[model samples]
Target chain A: MFKDLDPLLHSQLRLAVMSLLIGLESAEFTFIKEKTNSTAGNLSVQLDKLSDAGYISVEKSFKGKKPLTTCRVTKKGLRAFEDYVTVLKQYINK
Target chain B: MESENQILSTEQSLEIITRMIRQAHGSAKRNSVYLIVWGVAIILANLGMFILIWVEYPRPYLVWLIAIPAWFATFYLSYKHRQEARVSSHLNRINSFLWYSYGVIIFTIVVFGFKINYQLNPIILLVSAVPAFVSGTIIKFRPLIFGGVLFWLFGIICFLIGGPWQYLVGAVAVATGHLVPGLLLRNKNDEQHVQGS
Candidate 1:
């Protein structure tokens, strides 16, 4: 039997965001937007979902009068990602 | 990408995974500024000291002061780099730690050079290899590995040369080890930038 895919990370945009965050210490909101090529409103909604799910931590601060938002995957998020990859590999191989 | 709410097949999911992971690898590119700056500085100091010593100057070591620019450049460029950085990665932290630790060790020896009173040529060269080799392996950059080899190989050779002539060997080691690899890294970063764009 195949393990279930993570619902929180199953969506295309959420998965993409998680994948990018997986390797970085932290990434700014603008960086994610550019990488994912998502509209600001859409990206913000997805980020909020991830934040609500406890899959990532978001920090809001000011950088010289500019509001900066940085996000990092939580330990819980890392575990979820790893498990997701394992299940993905099994699916791909089978 | 989520516009139509199309369901992903296994293949599409796999593709996303691969693409994102590859994107993550993009951070592997070295900043190169530090490497180039120190390489040029150390190379100049080594060659200048050797020449001064060859001419029987009272303070051949004073030539090392030429490296003052390298320190200034490091501070200025790193600050600028931090300002511009959009994201921080684990690789960046590792690189920072390795080089900063090596920097501390180098300065410590320079400070206590008088107490040791023995020739610094071999000691400095030998110690310098640790950071270069480890970083090369971590980044999988071969030029830096060769640079480390140059340091270790000629470091032992410096032992045989002895005296002021050791300065010459030090010059060669750093020229091949630091400067050459640094330039190669710079070129590599440029190529990666083109690809990324």
Candidate 2:
């Protein structure tokens, strides 16, 4: 029997973001947007959803005068990503 | 590139994960500036000290004061780099902590070990080898690994061959072990940039 995929990570952009953050200590908003090739608005919304779910932590700070938004994956997010990958492999192998 | 809520097929999901992880891995490019700066500084300081000693100057050790400016420059550059960097990796964090610890230990040694007489070269070189070896291993940079090994070899030689001549040995040690590897790393970084562009 195959396990169900995590709904939060099943989406394209969110999965991309999680995968990016999984190996990083942290990443800035612009970096995430650039790597994911998503619009700022869409990325922000998705990031907010991930933050709300406690899968990631977003910090807002200032670099000189410019505001910087940084995001990092949480332990929960890592677990979810690992589970998603395991289930994804299960589905693929079948 | 669809809607944020669009669920991907299993293959697409796997592809996205694999691609993003690859991107993340590539994002953390090694900046050769730290190695280059510190290498040049050490070389210059050793050379300066050797010259001062040869001239029979009363304040031969004062030549090390040149390191103060080098330290300031390193700190400034590091701060600037941190500000400009978009992403931070676990490898970078670990490397930073390792170097920071090295800095603290070196500072303590310089300040307190002054009570001893001309026994610093071997100990300093020995201590320096750890960061170079560990960093090279972590980054998979062979030149740096070899450089670290040279530092160890030179440290032993410095211990066996004593007196004012030790300054010259220090300079040679740094030239081969630190400066040369640093220059090679800079060249590597330049080539990477050209290829990337």
Candidate 3:
């Protein structure tokens, strides 16, 4: 049976973030933005959506007086990603 | 780099995954400085000790004071690297911790070994291998893995080579482990930057 694609992750920016975060233990907000080439306003919205869904966690703090925001993919997010990829493969391989 | 509204094809999603992973791997290594600095310092200390010993010079071991300058350079370059960086990866952090912590371990072994009246050449090499191998595995870099193995092999050989001559083995291991890899990584990064530009 074909598993359904994760609706939350099917979005382009969200998927991009998930792909990058999977390779890393954690990444900063700016790092994600730079890699994704997404504008601050839009990326923030997507991040909120993902964060609210329990797919990722956003931590805010200061880095030497400058505010630092870091993001990490959660365990649930990892499972969702893997399942999404597996479902994606079924489509791609056919 | 695409519109959010459009449905991505399966091939496109796969491509994104592959591309992003490659990009993550392509991020600036920042390890060239550590390798080059420590490599040069170790080589100088080893060869200087060898020469001093051969000439029957007093306080030949003081040549290791070169590390004082290396310590300074490490701090300066690290600050510079941090200033210039836009993003720092988890891999980069781990690599930094591995080498810097390994540095303290090596320094302690050398200084304390002197006080204890112990031969540290073999011991130092054995210790050096830990960081080299672990860092290599972390980055999936083969040269450093080979360098770690070289340290282990040379460490054993130091016992056979005997006395001041073990300094030669130490030098060779440093050259292989740090110097060679530093130069290669520098060149690789340079080439990558050029291609990127």
Candidate 4:
């Protein structure tokens, strides 16, 4: 059922981010940046796309005097990820 | 009004992604506060017990039993909070580590204070390794795995050292092992808060 949905999440960068986030309750911008090896500009764009699709959420705050950004995956996102994985399995099985 | 088929601008996409991540986990401020409070209380209780032992107090063993109820309290509070806020598995894993640490510390003090003759080497190793192992497995944290290895080494050392020094070594082992990791976790939590805003 979800096999067809897997490709929606298979993008190299987006998949990396999603995979990392799936394992975290929340992750700091720096952590994600380091993990994905993506620039702030690029990562920000990808994050926005995911958020628009209801896959993740981003919060911006000031830590001391510095700007801090953190991200967490929503329940909707989790469901989508699960569905996506299920879809991917069908393709693999075939 | 030019064309409806145009894709979102890069900036717009980024904004949407950020929002999605934000919505992934609900507000954890309350849970964070609860955990901080719990950590402080546990530290205080341990300190109190330590002082009591230093004073040659009686029935210091009873202090250990306080953990049983404390565990229940923590469970209840966490359960209640879980209903109010969506806590990630990562946060819960860290919380579990904290509680397990507290339990082990209290248990160690109680056993040692009462002059109980139980062989503590294996028990201590198991207690310390379990949380580290779980953390590593669930969170894929190398630091925790390394900490677990250190604990195992300490356990072996305790067995080899034997005699009175075993107590001192055990104290040092735990202080360095669990306490250090707890402190590191607290620091990480602080960093997250800084990042989370």
Candidate 5:
């Protein structure tokens, strides 16, 4: 049986972000930017979108007086990822 | 002086807190799986060595060395998974520490088992200390640090006692150091999952 997932997360960059967050306890903004190869502006936009959808939580803090942004995946995000993969499996299987 | 103050509604605060908790839980779940797998593999390898020793096999110590490649394979798989999935640095740090601990254990065994002066066998206990210290410093896990300290003491005692007992001390120290912390993390992950659900 296929599970329903939010279509918003199906995009490549957003999916990449969710995938990364899904595997991490938390990730710094720079680390996510480096891994996804997304420009800061683009990543910020995508992160805001995910945060809006309640799929991620973004924490802004300071590391040694420098601003540090960290991201983590929510339960909703994990469920969405699982469902998305399940749906993708149908296409591959078909 | 009177100043205006804004208060967030309880509902809004709850929603935000819930989202944060979920995010933390999800990340914990993924990393926990990796730790559990590594833990089981380490325990099984030790069990195999124990069996070899029980059977009075020649050079039974060689069996413990199997963890070298096993750990390498685990790390490679983890790295590939991270690359494919794009796991974050927070998760990566935890995974890295776990694997690094494995590397330290393997190196210690190899060093004291073969290369180090036979007289310094007791120092092997202190070997586990490095990973323990790393775990404490990097992850802020006191248990791991405590476990490392215990191993250090055990190593010293084993050295004083002398003979094959050092081997047992080394094996037990390494095994517990990894196994206990792995299990604790696994349990914590499970609890988080349940709460999230």
Candidate 6:
């Protein structure tokens, strides 16, 4: 039997964000927006969704006068990503 | 970017993952600033000391004072780099720890150089090789690995040859080991920037 893909990670932008965050210690909000080629509003919404899911942690702070935001994958997020990839591989091989 | 809930095919998901991971790799690009700054500073100090000693200057060691400004420059540049950095990765932390540990160890050695009878050149060169070699291996840069080996070789030679000549040898060691590799790294960084643009 084939396992269903995680709905949270089945979208384009969220998957891209997770893929980017997976290899990094942390990444700034602006960096995610730029890399994903998404508008600030759209990226923020997706990040919030992931943050609410406990798949990632978001920290908001200030860099001088400007507010800076950074994100990292949580341990649970890592496990989820790994499981997602394994299921993905299985699907591809089938 | 697609719509908020736009579902992706398995192939599309895999493609996004691959592409994003490739983009993340850019964060790991080595900054050549520290290498170049220290390389030039060392070359200047070694050659300055050698020239003054050859000219019979009463305080040839005063040339070592050149390090004060270099330290300030490094501090400023590092602060600027930290501010500008968009992403932090494991490789970045590893590189920072490698250099920070090197600085502490070298500082300790320099403070106790007199206890070792001022046989500082050979000891300094040998100590310098560890970071260079490991950093090269970490970044997969062959020139830095060769530079590290050259440092080891020159360090051994320093032990064989004594006195003022050791200062001259030290200059050559840094020129090949530090300066050359630093310049090559800068060149590679520039090429990458141009291509990226």
TM-scores of the candidates are 0.92, 0.90, 0.85, 0.46, 0.48, 0.93
Enumerate residue pairs that collide in model 5.
A20-B86, A73-B23
Candidate 3 per-residue lDDT over residues A25-61, each given as its tens digit: 7778887888888898888989999999998999998
DockQ of each two-chain model: 0.65, 0.84, 0.48, 0.09, 0.07, 0.90
Pairs in clash, predicted candidate 1 = none
Interface RMSD of 3: 2.0
Q: Write the per-residue lDDT of candidate 5 for residues B1-197, one digit (tens) a residue.
A: 00112233334323433343354333333344444555556556556655776778887656656666766777787676554442244534664666576567756665665455544446645675665656544554555667778777877777678655555565576566656765675565343342110
What TM-score does each model's chain B reach against the true chain B?
Answer: 0.90, 0.86, 0.89, 0.51, 0.59, 0.89
Cα lDDT tens digits, model 2, A1-94, are 8888989888989999999999888999999999899999999999999999999999999988999999999999999899999999999999
What's the true lDDT of residue B84 in model 2? 82
In candidate 4 chain A, where is summed lDDT lowest over 10 consecutive residues?
A1-10
Query: Highest lDDT among the candidates is held by which one?
Result: 6
Candidate 1: tens digits of C-alpha lDDT, residues A1-94: 9999887787888888998898788989998888777888988998999999999999999988999999999999999999998998899889
The 10-residue segment with the lowest total lDDT in model 6 chain A: A1-10
DockQ metric, candidate 2: 0.84
Reference-based TM-score, model 5: 0.48
Writing each residue's lDDT as its tens digit, candidate 1 over B102-182 gives 889988888889997957789999998988887777677888889998899998998888777787788788888888887
For candidate 1 chain B, the 10 contiguous residues with the lowest summed lDDT are: B188-197
In candidate 2, stretches whose alpha carbon ends up further than 4 angstroms from where it belongs are B5-7, B26-30, B189-197
Give the poorly placed runs of model 6, Cα more than 4 Å off: B27-30, B189-197
Could you give the CAPRI-style class of model 6? high
Candidate 4, B1-197: lDDT as tens digits: 11213344434334434544543332223433333444444444545555666777886435545556656777788777644432345656575666567466846654684465755544565566665555544434445557677767877787777644554555555554555555555555432321121
Looking at model 5, residue B121 earns an lDDT score of: 43
lDDT of 1 at B103: 88
Which parts of model 5 have CA positions greater than 4 angstroms off?
A1-94, B1-57, B84-87, B90-115, B118-121, B189-197
- How big is the positional error of residue B66 in model 6, measured in Å on the Cα after superposition? 0.4
RMSDs, each prediction? 2.5, 3.0, 3.4, 10.5, 15.5, 2.5
Ranking by DockQ: 6, 2, 1, 3, 4, 5
Model 6 chain B: ten consecutive residues of lowest lDDT: B188-197
Score residue A45 of candidate 5 by CA lDDT.
Answer: 85
